[model samples]
Target: MDPATLIGIALAFIIVVVVNVMEGGNPMAMILIPPMLLVFGGTLVICLAGGTMGDAKLAMQGMVKAFTSPAPSAAQLVPELVTLADKARREGLLALEDYVADLDDPFLVKALTMAIDGTDPEELRDILEAEVHAKKAETKQAAKFWTAAGGYAPTIGIVGTVMGLIHVLEQLAQPEKLGHLIAGAFVATLWGVLSANALFLPLGARITRLGELEVAQMELVIEGVGALQAGSNPRLVAQRLRSLLPASQREEEAA
Candidate 1:
């Protein structure tokens, strides 16, 4: 599993605690249960109200994916596509069928299988591109759920803070306890802002980024499959696919 999300979130909380200690504040004081429930629980219900149950499921799945799934690598697929191109060029498109059973990527396998089945180049492109678009839409919806939660969290936090302040105001007769009550009241706002910036927003952004990477890899596969169907040269297919990758990844391939 990719540790980026885990590490980043852990570090963010650690930094917050460290800063609180540096300011001569009790870190444990910020861990109030009422505010935690209000901000986190309130944000969750509001987000659910804004979207359907399907979106919630997708969001949860996306969250798991963000924390666990490694980024897709289009650069790594280049060599494989080039090999397929070379094989098809030498033994013809029919030869690619032999390689299909051993291939791991379902996208590549599907594309090559269609090509081997004598699917028209234009029809194949249309079908593959349509699948890519559908995937993009799914990921977009999943990311939207988190983005909405991030947007709602701070506002929910403010509401919690206001409620806390209302309680603080009721204890006005106890002047000696005013400072402690005031501090405790603001914990709602703190958790709200903290969860949004450190957790929710980052997860939303990560899901979007991961989706883009996966889409890029799919697009690369489409192009590679198209080239193979058209009887393109292996070197040219390699060059075309490489051009679609980032400079950093291209450099890695060269190395």
Candidate 2:
């Protein structure tokens, strides 16, 4: 995890615990079974009911993958692609045919191979860009599921709070303790809101942004190689590819 994300999570938990201690209650109260069940169960029901089962399942898998495993960074890819571009320029585009096996990423290899096939520059751009958009849409579909789940979680939390309130109200003998019950019950809503904003929503956005950034870099490689294949000056091709970077990343050697 990024340091920023890690710090944010740590601070949120710290703040919650501090507040709970200030309330003269156990700091770990939220970890209690009733509150957890209310939050997760309610969110699950809302997601499963409001979204396709496939989307819900996909969203769960996405969240798991985001926490457990992250894909390689865009900067990590720059060297690999630069080598591919130099090789293509040196041996002719056709010569890249043999190196495709060394390339592991299906998307990158496909884009490079298409450029090597002497695909028209405009057509190559269109085809690769189209496929990128298609894959992006699919990837965003995974994020959208979490976004939709995030949207639904709060409402279900409110539902759970009301249910808790109803249950508490029915206990006539324990009326004096209703305040603590209600307070604890509302923790469900707190969990829902926090999970939505801090967890699912940000994670979904991060994955979407990362996917788009990587795709943009891949598109740059495709365009650069296309120009190289057409015998564009190396300086001109470098200039064109450099345009793909922001002013900051342009400082890289490839720029």
lDDT of 1 by residue, 131-243 (tens): 99999999999999888888988899899889988988999999998899899989989998999999999999999999999999999999999999889989999999999
Stretches of candidate 1 off by over 4 Å are none
TM of each candidate vs. truth:
0.96, 0.82
Task: Tell me, by TM-score, which candidate is best.
Answer: 1
* Model 1, residue 218: C-alpha shift (Å): 0.4
Q: Any idea what lDDT model 1 has?
A: 0.92
Give the range where candidate 2 is weakest over 10 consecutive residues by summed lDDT.
68-77
Pairs of residues clashing in candidate 1: none
